[model samples]
Target: MADSTPLLSDSESDKPPEPKRPPRSLDETIERCIGGFGWLQIFQAILVSLAWVFDAQQTFISVFTDAEPSWHCADESVCSSFSNICQLPKGSWSWDWPAHTSIISEWGHQCSTSFITGLPASSFFMGCLVGGLVLATLADSTLGRKNMLLFSCLTMSLSSIFTVFSPNIWIYSALRFMNGFGRATVGTCALVLSTELVGKRWRGQVGVIGFFCFTLGFLSLPVMAYVNRSSSWRTLYLWISVPTILYCILVHFLIPESPRWLFVKGRKEEAVTTLKGLAQTASALTMSFSNVLIEQESLDDNVDIYSSIRILLNKRWAAHRLTAVMVTGFGIGMVYYGMPLGLGNLSVNLYLGVTLNALSELPASLITFFLIGKINRKDSILGFTILSGVCSVLCVVMGRVWPSLQIAMELISFFSACTAFNMTLIYTLELFPTCVRNSALSMVRQALVFGGVFSPLLVAAGRKNNLISFGVFGMAIGICGLPLIGLPETKGGVICDTMDEEEHRQTEKGSAAIPTLA
Candidate 1:
């Protein structure tokens, strides 16, 4: 009516675009960051979080079982009491006997069950080791995140059920291993799913929030252990299993397939429909509806399976890879496995100590979230690594000087290690392009497993010379931090979608007159 085309052109040319502002309301910010997931997704995230709690509960029930009372008959009672009470010559023991002797002694004799319980725990991690590399890669290819998550949950639930019915330690361990295989799929897929849903501005926050859920799982373990302490280990296993099975069913129905993965696989209509549904759910107002067209670009369908491997071997990536592996491997290996074992040695309240250790993760997550946006990635990583290393050294020195301080030292060490571990995960995710993100993450996961394997040996060796193991662990953390000087800072940078973009950024940085490591 009023020269609309000319007015629009003139207005567009004259007005400058508004600068992106930080969100004022936390809820609005989170919604903006998470995009389109809505209340159902939050509920799903909670369910997934609880599933992880059960996962840890299943593994940690052993510690409570190990410390439970057992029944044992005295030699005199064995000779006198025969039949149901006690069998003298046959060496058979029953539940009934003298109050103190039967409950405490006989129960103590069955303490080997606790050790046997640990076999499944180890097997679960081993399963994670295998599944992370094998099943996680499928997140990008054949299986989308939703399907993979459902499969993992289903298998893990089945394994948990089987574990509850396990006739012996071997069956329990095998089922736990199977469960671990499924558990391995959860973290990676959850990560990919969260990242795909969000825009670039909020990827880090979403990643950290996902890890926060994991930390919640860790924190909840001690509560479960404390509640189930008086119950039979089998009962404890059953308690943990039921919730996970229910969660699996919920996930199967409620969670949708990742639209990005659908797009990648050339399921354009499905992806478009899914996006539309998400928009409807979020009540998102500013979506570019006209731009909803599915544009297919030429993708490298023939990409080498070993492509990530080659990149990791390259000079630029190799250094970061080695640093990430060594630091993360050591940090997670110590923080997760070492804390419980160390607490067991100190005769401290294992559940309390573990809970405290897990609770420390909240602050760590907060620290990373605050600092990741402001500071350089390399500095944040290096700073945390040094902090952990210093704590490790303190653990050694303090453990020798005052045995009472061992508990305190363990707490400090756990906090430091967890902070470093969280940083390493974020840094590793930041280092790679989207095309090979899963593969690169898998490589780092492999390093974590490798570290896990060595952790037991280190703990065993520490039994002989406690100071030595702590010292070695501390030194490793400090040394690993040093190489970070060479690593590039990725804070505030657009996440690279391809290797070419990454290489171009590197070239541009290299050509700049000013040195840019900071």
Candidate 2:
């Protein structure tokens, strides 16, 4: 209070000269990022795409493995001794217990061997649930995206190979769990990496591209399954792991650490060097390295892990968090996991069902790409969730009245549900600001894993009671979309770079009144 003006003037005079700021307009940032790292970004995208493809291949292998018929000898000793011998007649082996003469009959033999073989499948998602939530937070703060990707790739590849040699189901499941933990690391790290490389304008598109690669993985699984159909299941695991291991080697030499993470950690020189390397790889001639200094934004002094959690749970984001949990949990849990298990109960061609389901994801992703720019995200999500729920309810009706239409109903429901699943992935990324983006995303992913955990159990329970499981699932899916009504529309909206800006915008829109940064 005493001579405050003089003291302020003196402090201002003594302060070090401020560094020049780079351009911050949305368009300029987008243009600079595209102009600088466009081609290399595409390469990075492809590598990430392959990683996801392998992940899907690993997940759905159980379906194809179960579809293949197995031979059980009458003599226990013969069965035990000759199990590794590949002498069964081509296409005659059936893993279904109490084999049925009519493959198309509604009461056709359930492939119990696949269930037994795949019992360990849940372990992977369990590992993913734990690892993604806990280890993923370090991706931004300590390890950085590049090293995380490299480590995940190495771990998953080695584990996949180890799974192939698993002496029994118990050993195999344990190995698969390890593989899943590594895969989760890849999923979270890759998304964080891609988003960090671009400015706010391209975050949605890049996130879509990241999920798109996962669908590509689904597509690749069928080809891999078909190729290894004659070989032992262990051989199939080995073949899939090989290419991923090779890619890991390539990642070490090619990918750079995320520049955004570098800037945030006060490693300005490293960030500039990495950006320049990307520009060189992209052959960008117009980029001015000297003009690309990272501009530091003032953040709250109390920033910590707990503060980030509070930010995501604040009044402004509560609806978004709720929508993410409900939609992702129910959509993927019911549709993606439920359909395959249910179909296996009714038919021997579980691979056919899985392939059809995977195929549906392609159109879903394409639709998301086309409509994400055209439609409001909230509306699109609600529309697709409603469509999927209706389709699921229809399946229940079709299964009862016209049992012959069960396959058709399943295929249709899968198509609609997959669209919702893909959109959930895209929309969740769009909902949060950058300051706590990874944390918020990890929270949503944890919900997805929670949902995934319940899917197999629900499908198994549904096999005993017709329509009960699906009706409950449909209700859950439809009800989840109700929260979308409260979420702000984010389609084509530029992502906010910091919490303060997000709060300011929310206040301007009369949504909420959060504290702004100094």
Candidate 3:
């Protein structure tokens, strides 16, 4: 036994030293050094969230800008200010709005030109599709989150600026498409960057701020539209664009590259500098934070930016999860984007309708911010989707029998849909690791845009048929949720850094497990 013990000691001496783990995770280190929910973190998140505001405004601006104007019969010049122009014969009516106010009004779009009016909205969504396919990878790779966000914001703002000068609807539609292309990465990049900047304990709180900003932007639209009701729509574009252009400059100066992403790319020195800045901001007494550089959490992030999606899709479970989330997101996207465009069928005040619809986002944001921390993400997504779907179906059934009741129900559905959208985004953030998080989200959001591409066409073609507008949205969201049954609950699990780790994680959680944020 003594001889054997010496042999064991010799063998042990020859073994390599076990690699040391990081003293604490980046999230933990940030919290301990900078204080949990620190002002520095909050300020960074708020700055990043400004992008959401501009994104939301530009996304829904078309509802006001492209809307068909009120009109009266040209022959019936005797018609006073008191009558409904829609009641008169369609062919005799000319637009009440000036050519510069709305493209539909400027181009003399009656029945003959009605189809072209939907083109701009569709074109914008199509641009989103193309951009997501193209630009999503840059954030995960060389450009990083801050750079991609700044670029997207700059491009989107510049596109909006140029849109104000378009000579015709065709040029205007083309510019809007370019704007969509530029804006495609803004929400994804902003959300990922801002959330990663904070500790896990504060991630939910910080994430909700983006949604709140989006809701604020939505609310602002009605007020802006009302204030500019008599002015050219071009003026609205110009007003919104200038601030965003300035925001791009602020982001460049203020927002740092995501430290998490820097570590993923093996840029440890930069990560050290970023953390040092955070410590300095919090007035940390000790800046000897060499532990931040000692051990990076994982090296599984995509070094090959071009094949990030391939890395994601090549994994079986990942492919399945992505497929399901994207399909469901498409359904949600259709409803979220469709409601504003379809509101005119309710025969309510356009301004009031927009205000009410926009107002719904407030409660949606509050409810989402409140419950997401408590409930399971799957339960929240599945339950809210069902509720929103029911409300939409009711809108169609009760639209004629009780018009006022129908509007109320539609608003409820819109609010519910917004809540579902918020939950889905939060849930999506947990589904992938830091390596592919931005890319996955970018692609999923593009699925929403793909669904949105069809919404404007449907709203225009099915103006009289409430079922085509509301019913399709309801059915798609309600039924598409079936696939979610196969997806696991991802409420309290660690995010997997590699496909193998994630697959094993799914097994340990009993096969129905979904990815989760830690």
Q: What TM-score quantifies how close candidate 1 is to the native fold?
A: 0.76
Candidate 1, run of 10 with poorest lDDT: 22-31
Regions more than 4 Å wrong, model 3: 1-25, 74-94, 280-287, 297-302, 496-511, 514-518
Clash pairs, model 1 backbone: 70-106, 70-107, 70-108, 71-105, 71-106, 71-107, 72-105, 72-106
Clashes of 3: 1
Global local distance difference test of model 1 = 0.59
Candidate 2 TM-score, true structure as reference: 0.79
Candidate 3 C-alpha lDDT tens digits along 2-30: 55545457778999999854234455556
TM-score of each: 0.76, 0.79, 0.91
TM-score of 3: 0.91
Ranked candidates, highest TM-score first: 3, 2, 1
lDDT tens digits by residue: candidate 1, 256-292: 6765555445565675566665553334545543344
Q: What lDDT score belongs to each candidate, Candidate 1 first?
A: 0.59, 0.63, 0.80
Expressed as tens digits, the lDDT of each residue in 34-80 for candidate 2 is 55447777787566546666667766665554342544555454454
Best model number under TM-score: 3
